[model samples]
Target: MTAPAVTVRTGMLDCIQANLALLADRWGEPLRHLALGAHLRFRPRPGPDGLPTVDPPPQTHIRQARALIGLVPRHVHHDLEPEALRALSRRTPVVYAVGDTHDMPWLPYAGRARMEHSFLVSGEAGEACVEDAYDNETAWGPARPGRWRLPWEQLPTARTAVEFTAPAAYRAPRPAVALDDPGPYVQAYAAHPDRLTALRRLTSETWLMARARHLHAAYREHRGESPDTHEHLRRWDRLTATAFIALRRAERGRPVPDSLLPDLAAALHADREVFAVRDEQTEPPDPT
Candidate 1:
C-alpha cells in the first residue's frame, strides 16, 4: 500500500510534546498555551541504593494541559494488531509508545539498544507513516526528527497508542493566555525540605525544567513581550547544568563543595526577584 505524504516540524523538547504539536498543527489548533504554567512537581521514590530518586511527574500533567487547550488524549493499553492500527490511522494519527526503540529503524537507537519511546504514526494499508520530532542527544546517539514509512509487519511492536479527540465545543486556534508568575515555582524548588534529594533529581530531570523555561520563552516571544524573557532561558540552562555537574561529581565519589546547594538557592532567589520586578512593571495602574 502507498503511504500518504505528510509534513512535520521539530521544536518541542520531547516526543510527547512534539507529537501533540503535530496533532495541533494538523487540526489547525494553537499550542503555545502548553508552554504556560511552567513549573516542576518533585516526587521522589526510593532508588536501588535506598536513597530517594526523583522521577518526572506523571502523565496527568500532560492530560490537564491538553484539556486546557481543548484536546483530550485517549490511551489504549491493549496492543492492536497491525491491520487494526492501519485502519485506525486512516482516521487520525496515532501517538504510539513502543517498548523497545531498537525495533524502530528511523530512530538512532535502532540496532543499538532497547529504550521505551513514543512517536506519531499515520497512513494506512501498505506502510505505516511515522513522524518523530524529538531531535536530541540520547544514550545511543543524536535522535533526529524525520518522517518515514514502516512495513506492516514491523508496526505491531507498539505497546500502546494515544488518539486525541475534541469535545463538542472544540475550537481551532486557541489564544495564548497570560503567563503564570514564576516566583512561586522558583521558591518551591529552592525551599524543598530534602535539598540533597532534590538536587539529585534535578540532575536527571533538568531537561524537563529547561524545556518548561524554553516554552515560557516561546510564549513570551509569541506575545511580543520583552526580549528579557529569553535571558531566563539561559539562566535555567546554567542552573540545571551546574546541578547536573555537581551531582555527577558526587556520584563519582569526588569532593563537591559545600556551597553548591547554597549557590543554587541564591540563584533561585535572584530569579524570583527578576520575576517580581517584571510583574510589577507589567501590572496595570490601580483604578480609583
Candidate 2:
C-alpha cells in the first residue's frame, strides 16, 4: 500500500495516532490492527468469564503510543541529558513532554488544571520547533483538527519524565492470523482503560460516545445552526446508547442479540467515516 497521507492536524494523542496510521500503512497493515495487536500482545489469555483480560503495566499508554507511532520509545524521567539533547537536535521528529495544562498559561486550563501530556517535536534548528493540537482554542473550548507550534523552551515540563524514541521496524502477529483469532484484541480493549485502546476499539460504545460528544460540540459551536449536525448528534447518541447495551451484554458474558448486530455494524462504519482520511487510496474495512 502507498503511504497513508496525513489527515487534519491535531494534539499530541491525535497526532501520534495519525502518525501511527501512516506507519501502519508502511507496514502493510491497518493502524487499528497494528495498535490493537500491540495491546493484545500484552494480554493473550482469557479470564475466568471467558473474556480476555490483561494486567496493564504502569503507563500502558506509552506502549500503545509507541505501537501507534511504529516506534520503540525510550523513557526520560529526569532532566534532558546531553545525548538526548543531541538526538532532539536531529532533523527527525521526536516526542516531548508538556507537564500539565495548568502550567500552560495560554491554555484554557491555565491556573486551574493539569493533565500529563506530550507533543510532537519536529525540526530543530537553534531551538526545537514543536507542534501541538492543544494550543489551538475555539469559542466552545479547546478544539482539535488544527495544530500550532512554538519553541521547545516555551513548553512546560509537567511530567519531567517522558517517553521518546525513533520509529522501529513493525513487529507483531500477522494481521490475518491475529484477526482470525480476536481473543487478544477483545480482551485488551475491555481490560485496559486508556485513550490508546479507546481509539483502537473504534466500534466500542465508550469510544463512540467520546468522539460523538466532541464532534457534536464542535458542530454546534463552529458549524453554525445546521440540521445535519443536530441529526448527526441524535443518531450518534442513539447509537451510543445501543452500543453501551451491547458492551454491557458482552461484559456480562451474555451474547449480543442477532437483531442488534446490524446497528452495531452501522455504528462502526460511521465511526470510521468520521476519522477516515478521504484520499485517493482505497482502504480495507475493519475486521472486528
Candidate 3:
C-alpha cells in the first residue's frame, strides 16, 4: 500500500513561507524585510560606462536563505542526515536544503551538479515521505509511492538543514510584515565577529562597485525580452543588488550614508512593487 503524501506548497519564496506557516497556527516572530530588494539582494553598482550593473555570486540564494532563516524559529541542525529525517514529527515538517536534482520540474536549477535546493520531509508509519512544492506534480521515485524519496547519494552537500518542532503548549505570536528599520537586523548579524569578518570580505569596496555594474547590465539585457521569464530575472537582479548593499553597509557600520539611504529605500520599494504586480499577474483569477 502507498503511504499518503504530506502537504506540499510551492513558489520560490512561498515554499519557505508556507512551511513556516505550517509550523504554527501562526508564527510568533515577524518576517523582516530590510527590503524585499534586500531579501532579493539588489545591488546597484556602476559600470565602465557608469551605468548600474548587476551580477550575483553563485551562492546568493543560499546566502539569502541563510540570512532570512533568522526570522523563523530557533530549532535547527546541520547535515545530520537520516537521524534528522527519523526525528521529524507528523505534526511539524522538517525543511531540508540539498544539492540540485533533475527530478523536480519547477526548478530551472534542477539539472545543475551542485548543492542548491530545499524541500520538506515527514514520516508515516516508519516510512519517510518527501514533500516538495516544486515537485508537486512530478511523480517519481518515492513520490511515485505517494511519499517523498530523495536521492540518497546527494545528501552530503546539504546545508542549513532544519527541523521544526515545538512543545505542545507553545504557540508563537503573529509575524510582522516588515521591520521598522533594517539596522537592527544588520547590527545583530554584524555583531557576530566571525560573520562580520565574512561580510567584510564579501563586501569589499571594489567588489561591490563592480557588482552594481554587473547587476544593471544583466537587468537591461533581460528586461522586456520574455514575458514569462523577464520579470523573474529582473527580480533576481534587484534582489542581488539589495544583498550587496546591505552587506556593504553592515561592513561599513550600520548606518548607510544619508545621501544614499533614500535611493536605497526607493529601490527597495520598487522591487516590492514589481513583485506584487508580477505575483498578481500570475495568480489565478478569482471566481467572484
Candidate 4:
C-alpha cells in the first residue's frame, strides 16, 4: 500500500487528517497510543515491490527538537521533553503513570521500563511519578500512588541530584485533557474538516509516544541524570508516524513510503499494544 505524502512545510500543517476522525472516535486509547509512540511514524519501509530499509536508527535517539517537529508538524516545542512537561503540571502533584495490555480505556503512562521508589520525585509542592510496566499494556490513568516504580538502577539515591531540565521542543505533548475528548477547544474547532483530521492523527500518535517517554524521563529524573534530547523518542515517533501515514495512504489507494515495511515490522510492542498497526507485517488480525 502507499503512504501519505508528509511534506513538512512551515505552518499550514493542516491539509488532510482522517486520523483525527478515527482518533476522536476512539480518543482515550488512541491518545495514549500517540503518547506512547504507537502508529505515529510518518515513514515506513516499502512493501515487497517498493520498500524502504529501517534499522530503528542508532541507540540513544535523543529527539532533536527540530526533527521531532518535522515528524508530526505540530506546535508543541516546549512540552516534548520531560522537564518542560513537568513545568506544565507544576500544580499536578503526583502524576500517576501506569500501563497494561488489556487495552484499558485509560493509562497514565506507556513504555517497556519501570520506575523505582528511589526515583519518586517531588517538586516544591507536587510530585511527578512515572510507571513503565514491561509486558503490560493498558490505557487508563490518574494513577493511584505506589502503583508502579522505576528500576533500582535508574533511580538516584540523592534527592538533591534531581534537577529541572530545560524545556525541549522535541518531546510529546502532555495530555491536553484528562479524558479522551479534546476538551472544549477541540470540540469547538473540529468543524474545520481538513485541519481537524490532521490534528486528530497528530494527537493520537503524539499522546502515545509521550506516554512511553514519560516512563524513561521519570527514570532519568529519578537517577538525577540529564536527558540528552531523548533520541529514541524521535525515532519511535518517526516509525509510528511513517506507519500512520502509510496506512492512510493505502486507504486512499496510494503508494507506501520506502520505510513502511521495515519500520512497520520494528514497531515496539508497547507502542503497538494500544494503537495496533494494521499492515502485512503484523500477524493476521484475529477474526473474532
Candidate 5:
C-alpha cells in the first residue's frame, strides 16, 4: 500500500480562518471550541503601505472560554485544546484541532470527536472540552484520523513554514473590560467584571419600579411637574438585574456555556422575567 503524504502546507490566508470560517461554519465542516472569544484572528488588515498586510494582527487567543457566561464565571474552568473538540460535537460528528499546542508541534484530535446528537455539557465553556489525549503538539504532522503534531524543522526540505498573527472578532469579554472599574452604564450594558455588579443588581431584586418612581417623584417634587413617565426604565432595570445576577453567580458560579450566551442575550432583550423581574417563581424560594 502507498503511504500518505507525511506533511501538508497552505498559505497563511487559507489556514487563517479555514478552520473556523470554512470548517466550523456548518455540517460537514469543523467547529471551533473556543471559550472566551478573544481578539485572536486570521483575517488581515490594511498595512501602513496601504497593501494587504498579512502580518500578525493585534489579538489575544484566550486559552479558556471565559470567567463568566453573563457576568459570572462557571464554578470550574477548563484547558484549551479540549474545549474545541467538545464544541464541534454539537453540529458535526467529528472535531479537529489544527493549532495551539504548548511544547510540541501541530496536533489534530479525532478520537474525541463529538456527535451533536449526544452532546450534553452541563455548565462549561463550549471550548471547555476534554484535554487532548496526546501530548501538546508543536507544528504539523502527517494528516491522519487523530491528532498530528509536527515541528517547523520537521517539514520536508521543499516545504516552508511561515508565521503571522491571525485576526478575529470579539465575542467574550476580556481583561480590558474589567467589571470592578466600570460605571453604572457599563455595568448595565456589558457582561464583563463591571457587569458582575450589574448582574448581581438585576437578580438581587432592587425593585427598579420603585426607584423609577422615586427618581420621578423627586423630579416632580423639585420641579413641581410630572415624573419622567417615558417608560424608558430598561436601562435602569438592566443595571439592577445584571448586578444581582452577577452577585448570585459569583457566589454560586456556573452558567450554561459561552456558546449559549448569545442565545441568552437574545431572550433577555430587557424582558421582565430577565431584567424587570426574576423568571424563577413568584411563590417564593423552596426551602429544603
Candidate 6:
C-alpha cells in the first residue's frame, strides 16, 4: 500500500527557508518575517572548486529566525538510516542536505554532477515522499519542482538532516521588528573592496540574497506599502542576472566589462533612494 502523500506549497528561493516556510504554514504561523533584516555582506570562503565563494549569514541567523515562529531546528549528521529518517518524517517534514545530488533521481543534477543541495521529505511510511520546490537556473539546467517517491532501499544517506520540532508548550511568536532601512546594506555592498570577486561569488550564491529581497518585498506588501519594495525586487533580479552573465563571460576567457560592478552598485543606490523617499512620505507629522 502507498503511504499518504502530504501536500506542501512551493516556497521561496532559499531551500531551507522554503521548507521552513512550509512547516510554519502547516503549524498556522506567520513566516513573512523569516528574512527580515536580510542584508548583503561579503563573507568569502573557499568553495568546492577551490575558488573563493560568498558565504551566507552565520547559522545563528537561521536559528534566530526559526525561534521567531516557535520552532526549534535540530541538525543531525550521522546515523541517517532510512528507518530513522522515516520516523523523523512521521513527526515533522525533514530537510535533508544531500551532499551529492547525483544519487537523487528527482534533482536536475542526478546522474550528471555532484552538487550539494537540500529538499523536503514530507512522508515516509511505505516510501519517502519527496517534495523539491527549488526552481532555478543552474549550470546543470533549470531545476523545476518535483514530487517523487524514493523507495526505502534507494533513500540516499544525507550529509545532514534538519528536523524542526515544536515544543510541548507552544511559545508565542516574538513581535517582529519592521526593518525598513536599506541604506546601510546597500552601502556595504557598494563599498566592498573586492567587488569583482564578490560578484563572481554571487554567481553561485545569489539564491540566498535573492530570497532575502523577495521576503522583504512580501513583508512590505503585507503592510500595504510596497510600491518601492517592488522596485527593490526588480533591481535585485537584474543584479543577479548581470552577475551570472559576467561569470559566464569570464569562464569563456572573455573580458568582463570594467563597468559591471559600478553599474550594479549605482542601481542598488537608486533602489535605496526610492526606499528613503518612501519612508519620508510615510512618516507621521511631528506632534510636538
The candidates, ranked best first by TM-score, are 6, 1, 2, 3, 4, 5
Tens digits of lDDT, candidate 2, 1-288: 012134322221231233333333444433332233221122233432333433222244455545333555565554553345335446334555435656554456656754444444444455544444432332237633323344555556534434455464654322111112334444354456552333223333333243424433342233232223345456656665555555556667676544443553454345343333233223322222
Q: What is the lDDT of residue 126 in candidate 6?
A: 77
lDDT of 1 by residue, 1-288 (tens): 232233333443555555555555565445534433232223333442234333322254345535444557665544666677777777665654434577777777788866456677877466887777666776567777677787866754666666766555643222232233434444454566765665565565556656655664554555555546556667767777787777767678786666555654554444444443243234312111
| Each model's lDDT | 0.54, 0.40, 0.37, 0.30, 0.27, 0.54
Best by TM-score: 6
**Count of clashes, each model:** 1, 2, 29, 67, 50, 0
Candidate scoring better on lDDT of 1 and 3: 1
Each candidate structure's TM-score, on Cα atoms with residue i matched to residue i, is 0.64, 0.41, 0.35, 0.23, 0.18, 0.67
Who is ahead in TM-score, 3 or 4?
3
lDDT of 6 by residue, 34-54 (tens): 433223223344453344444
Q: Local error of candidate 4 at 189, Å?
A: 35
Identify the runs in model 4 with alpha carbons over 4 angstroms from their true place: 1-210, 227-229, 264-288
lDDT of 5 by residue, 1-288 (tens): 122221111111122222222222222211222211212111223433222222322121111222211111112122323333343345443333333222222233223321111111111232222112221221234322123333222211111111112224423222111111113322233444444443433332233222422332332233333324334344444544554444555667655223223422332343222222123222311111
Candidates by lDDT, descending order:
1, 6, 2, 3, 4, 5
For residues 1-288, what per-residue lDDT tens digits would candidate 4 score against the true structure? 112222211011110111221222132322222222211332222222122221122111213211211122122221123354355336433222111222221123424322221111233323333322222222343332122223322322221112222233334332211112123222232343554343334334443444445443432333344545356556656765665666567567676566533442343433334333233223321111
Error of 2 at 27 (Å): 10
Backbone clash total for model 3 is 29
- State the RMSD for candidate 6: 7.2
**Residue pair clashes in candidate 1:** 1-126
